[model samples]
Target chain A: MIEVQNISFAYKKRTPVLKDFSLSIAPGGIYGLLGRNGAGKSTLLYLIAGLLKPDDGKVLFNGVDTRLRKPSSVSDIFIVPEEFDLPSISLKKYLSLNSRFYPNFSEEDLHRHLDTFELTPDLNLGALSMGQKKKAFMCFALACNTPLLLLDEPTNGLDIPGKSRFRKFIVSSMNDERTILISTHQVRDIDRILDYIIITETNRVLFDQPVSKILSRLKFMTTDKQQLIEDALYSQPSVGGANIILPNTDDIDTELNLESLFEFALVNPQALIDAFTNNINA
Target chain B: MIDNRFRISRTFDLFRLYIIENRKFLLICAAAIVGILICVAISIASDVSYKRAYSMYRPDLDPAIPYLVPTYIIIGYIFAALGASFMFSELKSKQGRIRTLMVPANSSEKLISRMLVYVVLYTVFYVLAICIAEFFRDIYLMAKMTVAPVTPLYTIFGNEAAINFLTTDKYPILLPCILFVGVFAIQSFFVLGSTLWYKYSSVKTFALFFALFFFYTISVFMLGSSLSEGKTYNNLDHFMSNYFGYVFLCFEIIVCLFNWCMAWWRLRETDVITTKR
Candidate 1:
């Protein structure tokens, strides 16, 4: 579990990336942190991983301040940054050097994840292409078995098949004790696998709810009828029709459409918040 | 509860990992040192041969020994200083910083492991490289001066100048102790500067060091001139003659400790994405 308490951070001489932001993430679910570019999603992840200290307030992992970066706290958390470099060494050598730090590291789990990604254990990391390297790094990160995994842009640079396999790999690695927080702009790549959705902007969280809650409150559909578009809380044009989010007054269970929901959050954030909190009428 | 912050086992693991990651770079540095020293030896041999042919050769002395000592010292210091300054080069880039800081080791452990590699292990490697270079130098000289008198190979340990520099009368072991402390203090300054500026750390550290040294020298000169104006400082001479060495040695030790502490503090506060604190 992680808690972000009134944290503020900014890059040098730039506008504040996050101002008085607060968030709490409980264990066991895959959290999809969605935000547009420069919306402080990745900054939040880095702060949670203790790679960056907050300008004010604190981020705590299981009641311990993450910024302290104690060995005990760090061993339980693994972060795969959006851009990273693996040493020019064999996969086996790299694992041998790094896996010892994580007490729960499992070679068997590593092999399983690699298999899901259609990769083998015997890999010369330096010789692999960028996508292959990312797959390899992701597999290793999953195998670390840390309780908290922070992934920034996990699905970037992946082939279509690789993206599907990544979803499978993440699902297979999930357990009751582990929490995976993924920050990405590519919503379609991970939307199906996420248990919870959190959409944030420059200084505020627009929406935070479980997928089931989102589905139970708002209905997503594509229709050409202008009547439905007028009644919908949010609507956007699509290929054959318009994608719309309507109030689920009849308790109709519709699948959560992440892309439409993300756009809806950005366009009409107040209505989205009202639909969840005040129960919008049909 | 046991202190997990500074576990010896974890420190050893980190030390091993650093060596494994940097093995290629270390090999290249060792090769360069040996190659440069061999070239210097060959040049000395050529100069000796030229002198012999021109009938200006001194047969009693080995010209290479005098030059080799200073060459080894100067080159060794440069290599060590650069290595110390580059000790935190992994923190220069976002990716490197992430990998380094995310490792499950305390800040002290990380700093200590890197110091072992860039400071302690580098000294060991430099000594070995110099010895190997000396062996090759001796062989080349023997081959080049077959008809001329060939002095024995210079032994670093037994050399009179080295012995005198390392040991002194009155304070026999204090000389080498002070020398090591002084060297460590200088290296620590570079390491501290490395943490301050990650990119081009060595160049920045060198520039900053010289600038500070210049200002420090000026301040000392002005202060001394003003304080000693119209004052007969008779005890100053005696104090300088008797206790200056001890005072300077203590100062070096303090400086060394301070720089190391500051470097560790900076490293602990490092952020993966930010260049500025």
Candidate 2:
């Protein structure tokens, strides 16, 4: 489990990016952390990874303070940043250097991931295209088998086929113990895979809930009726009608439209929070 | 939970990774060292041949042996400085900064592992390079001696004159070791500077170090002048030789240790955004 307790952080001499923000992530399943630009999404991820220390409060991974960046915590976590550079060395050499750090690293898993990506370990990482390099790194990260995997914009450079392959690989690579947190603006890339969603805005968590719970509580619908659109908690016009979100008054399972849901949460965060809170109390 | 302290196995693992990533750079350094050694050997041999041919008539040819060892030591120091300056070079780059920080080891382990490679390992290589250069110099001298009567290779190459000059220390090894420490202490300062400043760290360090060095030198001179009043140059020389040298050595060690510790602390504070005040 990862617990962030009222962590506040900012770049020196700059305004605070995250102020007294808190969240917890339990093990298992994929989590999609969505936020507007400059909403502290990457900052939060860095704080959790122990890459940047919070100015106040703490981040704990399995009861260990992540700020310490101890071997136990670091070894069980791997982060793939949006942009990275690989050394001018063979993929095999790159893996040899990095793999030993992860005690659970699997050579067979690495080979499998590479094969899935149509990459061979013999290729020089520096020579590969950016997308290919990303795939190779993703392959290595998966092979590490760490309990927590943090991926920032993992699909940024991937082609359509590569993105599909990435989705497939992520699903196949997941285990019950692993908790994968993906932070990306490209919600469509990972909308189906995310079991949980976190939305942040203006240095605070606007929403944090499981997809199943969210789907059960909110009725996502497309309506042409002006009365229904105005009465809705959040609504947006579509081609033939308007996509709207309302309280699941009848407790029907509505198919989630993630883009619409994101817009709804941002526009009507208080209403969404109130509905969940009222439901919990009742 | 995680062990925050050092572990030998993990340190080795970190070191191994460092070597793998930097193997290309190390190879290039090795090739450059060898090339330098060969060049020095050829130059020294040519000089020896020229001296041997002219000495019979001129008879005033200065023996190069007395100066060669010290010259090679100076060369070794230059290479050591170059190698150490890039110790934290990766931290300057955007991708490398993130990757290095994200490597699954504590900051101390990471620092120590790199210190071992940058300082200790580089020192070992420097010593080996000196030894290899000495061997080439000896071989050239030996080939020269076959045709003409020259200074014995053993006396010159085995550090006879240099050792004899420092015989006051009893252990001849102490002098070279002391010299190594002095050079390493200065180089370690550059290592710290490289870690702290991102762009042209070595040049910046060089400037800062020399400026301070000159300031210290002037302060010491002025203080000595004030204290001596009407003393002779010989009296001041004696005081400087007996006391100032030891004080300077102590000062160097302190500066080296202080800067190295500061570098470690700075690394702990370092993050992806280096522009942060």
Best by lDDT: 1
Candidate 2's displacement at residue A266, Å, is 1.8
What tens-digit string does per-residue lDDT give for candidate 2 at B1-277? 4465778777888888888788988889987997797577557655654434434653432355445556666777777676678888999876788788878777778878888897888877766766676667667767655443334333444544445544344344545545767787878878888788878888888898889889987887776567668553444336434555566567778878888888888877777766545
| Per-model TM against the reference | 0.91, 0.89
Q: In candidate 2 chain B, where is summed lDDT lowest over 10 consecutive residues?
A: B147-156
Q: Which stretches of candidate 1 lie over 4 Å from their true place?
A: A12-14, B1-3, B42-63, B146-154, B158-162, B165-175, B216-241, B275-277
TM-score of chain B of 1: 0.80
Give the best candidate by DockQ: 2
Where does the lowest 10-residue lDDT sum fall in candidate 2 chain A? A273-282
List where candidate 2 sits over 4 angstroms from the true fold: A12-14, A223-228, A279-282, B1-3, B44-62, B134-159, B165-174, B220-243
| Per-residue lDDT of candidate 1, residues B15-99 (tens digit) | 9999988889888887998888778766765565424422344444455555655567777778878889889888888999989
lDDT of 2 by residue, A1-282 (tens): 999999988775468899999999999999999998999888888899888878899999999898777778888889999999888888888877788788899999988998888888798987989999999999999999999999999999999989988988899899999999999999988888889999999679999999999988888899899998998878999986999988788888888888888887798788888878887324
DockQ of 1: 0.54
Per-candidate DockQ vs. reference: 0.54, 0.58
